[model samples]
Target: MIFEMTTQVRVSNIEEGHKWYETLINKHPDFIPHKGFVEWELIPGCWLQVAEGELTEGNGPLRLGVTDIEGERERLIKELTIERFEIHSRPEVPVKWGTFRDPWGNRIGFFEYLDKKEEETQIKSILGTDSSRV
Candidate 1:
């Protein structure tokens, strides 16, 4: 059996969006940097592409469930000058997740399955429970 998924994100400037994905791939370990596309090969024969857009409301691949949410978020803020961006909601998902628009008005979400140990620690800290129980 074979399975594949492709998603698209709209952008105003393909060059800028390409650069953003390039930086992300360079900074993150999971991504395999490609000239025209940034790919993440989660497993053999399965990959995700982040590439250039061909239209005014450009459509590039969608990225979801990314493990390095905080790092990616910081990089986007530092590198790209987003015209306007907003966090639609907090990380209420089992996996820490949130959405934001890029400089070109492309909507993207960053997320990952929460680390069990990290989640336990976070819950304990919030409830003022003892570390020993975590």
Candidate 2:
């Protein structure tokens, strides 16, 4: 069976979230924004959703994988005009990843696969699988 998950993120302001999402969509054309949700289609008819809503205190944001880390960060800050975010401290994990918060205080992580070896290692580390599942 195929199991898919949808992560709901709470944003203090939907309008700001929409603008942030537009920045992402502009940078990554593969992403499509719909209403309050942004979708990434990994396969045919299989996708993931980044939705905006109300979040309680201590709730975290979503971690998204990216091919370019520095560029994404630059665009988010320079183009999107998102401030008041910080890169979270990461543990000694197999993958190279960084975390940042949105305008609404949602913590989002950005990960970059350094190489095929690192990518495989990250898949195992994240999914507890010996091989790629996606």
- Residue-wise C-alpha lDDT for candidate 1, range 1-134, written one tens digit per residue: 55565444434455665567556455432453655455555333445455555533544324455545776677777776433333333456567666776566556666655776675565565446764653
Worst ten-residue run, lDDT, model 2? 40-49
Q: For model 1, state the Cα shift of residue 55 in Å.
A: 4.0
- Model 2 lDDT per residue over 67-100, tens place: 6676777777887676634434346553466677
TM-score of 2: 0.59
Report lDDT per candidate. 0.54, 0.61
Q: What is the TM-score of each predicted model, taking all chains together? A: 0.50, 0.59
Q: How far is candidate 1 from the true structure (C-alpha RMSD, Å)?
A: 8.3
**Which pairs of residues clash in candidate 2, taking residues 3 or more apart in a chain or in different chains?**
none
